[model samples]
Target: EPEVTQTPSHQVTQMGQEVILRCVPISNHLYFYWYRQILGQKVEFLVSFYNNEISEKSEIFDDQFSVERPDGSNFTLKIRSTKLEDSAMYFCASRTGLNTEAFFGQGTRLTVV
Candidate 1:
């Protein structure tokens, strides 16, 4: 089955550095989302994108974070500046449409020191 794919499964960076988490969602899915899980916490939604625009975003998704499709095949999430609190596992997900199952990538583990 086609699945979402993320790069650099593990990333470690300094507190003030910038990082870009990349993903390639299922080719045919129309809706895409970025989610994060802090160490032991439950998953949290960060943002959703569709039709080449942001459809919705959570309060956790501040100006420091941004998402983009950049091209037909790749989706990305960028953190302007990393913070210790930003350490978490970032996941990329997608669904074909409303009411359908959303598939998630294996996730990128980010360690901000």
Candidate 2:
């Protein structure tokens, strides 16, 4: 099966630095979403985007975080200031349906040092 690719699969940085996680969602899908798993916690939705703008976002997607589709195949999430609580597996997923099964990338592990 085809897979979504992410760059810098793992990153470690000091706690106040900025970080951008990159992903290439499935080419044919219509909906894009960002989710994170903090340690062993359940996957939590951060945001969803479509039609070139944000469609929805959760409380976790606060002022510090933003997302964009920089090119034909790249989607990125930028965190203006990292926190220790930000250490988690950030996953990028895309689906044809808004509330159905989604294909998830292996994830970019962000570690706040």
The local lDDT score (0 to 100) that residue 24 gets in candidate 2 is 94
- Candidate 2: segments with Cα more than 4 A from true spot: none
Highest TM-score: give the candidate number.
1
Q: Which window of ten consecutive residues has the lowest lDDT sum in model 1?
A: 66-75
Across 74-99, the per-residue lDDT of candidate 1 in tens digits comes to: 99999999999999999999999989
Off by over 4 Å in 1: none
lDDT of 2 by residue, 1-113 (tens): 87778877999989999999999988887788899999988999999999888999999999999999978679999999999999999999988776667899999999998
Q: What is the lDDT of every predicted structure here? A: 0.96, 0.92
